[model samples]
Target: MAKKTKPIRPPADPLPPVIAPRVSAPPDPMSIDPEIQKMADDLSAKVHSPARDLELVDEFLDLYRRVFQQGNPIGLNEDITAVLTGRNARNGILFPPASPLIVKGQLVDRWGTPYWFHPNSSYQMEIRSAGPDKNLFTQDDVVKNPGPDNMGIGVGISQP
Candidate 1:
């Protein structure tokens, strides 16, 4: 009687090691270039008190326009506060990090709440204020959606 032999199985390929996605830390405010710091100070000094929602929205629109004129590409996923304050200033500095408008490294509203920024595209951004209530997404919340034309010489506002 012939002895039954077990079939030899080939070794299975080892699974690849999982690599975690790399997340970059936010830029340090103190490490900003001196030239950019000077530019931000100059621009920040020109900003007037934004008491109304329209003013706040207009401020953001004007910034976009200036960035466009500088020939810098707007980052759709970039933080507006960082971009404005020279931390992640891809479009150059437009606001000073030590300005009164910035509270705890955020761009605050008239009520001292951080403004929420939504970048719809390279040429479109939505600036939202918590309004007088200091709460967002309510009837009192003010949202201004500035489109592509506003980044040019033209100005327009879209509400959503």
Candidate 2:
């Protein structure tokens, strides 16, 4: 009979030594710029609604009109917007000589959905979008048009 021998140990990983992951330091909020912070706040406001309310729909509709139709007779829509936004100022004269318009925020409904602009006439356009239900071409959709005494109508809107 032969004597029993102890089992041999397996070799360890033949690579770099294992090291613990380095923890990152916390960021300093004070390092942020006021203007950038304000822009962030404005963007956040645009993506969300107050009390989840869509009261800004009317304001958005009015802005679309002024941006799309209120341009000078000979001014292109792009030129008008660029001028309004202080871009391509050389074309600014193409826009109305009156005080230039500056639209704020994004072209979105109160629900953060982009408003659809369907041009049906030279001076009139149909700006619409899905309302709170988030369904397009439905009764719960908002619609606004050109002309005096303009009013927006949709299912999500509560008429007083």
lDDT of 2 at 97: 22
Highest lDDT scorer: 1
For candidate 2, give the lDDT of residue 28: 44
lDDT tens string, model 2, 1-160? Answer: 9999999999987999889899897654224345433433443455654322223433332443454555232233333334433243222222222211222322444565655444445544455556787675566665554222223323333222
lDDT of 1 at 15: 95
**Candidate 2 Cα deviation (angstroms), residue 77:** 12
Q: In model 1, what lDDT does residue 13 have?
A: 100
lDDT of 1 by residue, 75-135 (tens): 4323556666555435455555566767777777667777766565655566666667777
Winning candidate number (TM-score):
1
Query: How many collisions between residues are there in candidate 2?
Result: 0
Question: Which window of ten consecutive residues has the lowest lDDT sum in model 2?
Answer: 92-101
Candidate 2 positional error at 11, Å: 83
RMSD of 1: 12.7
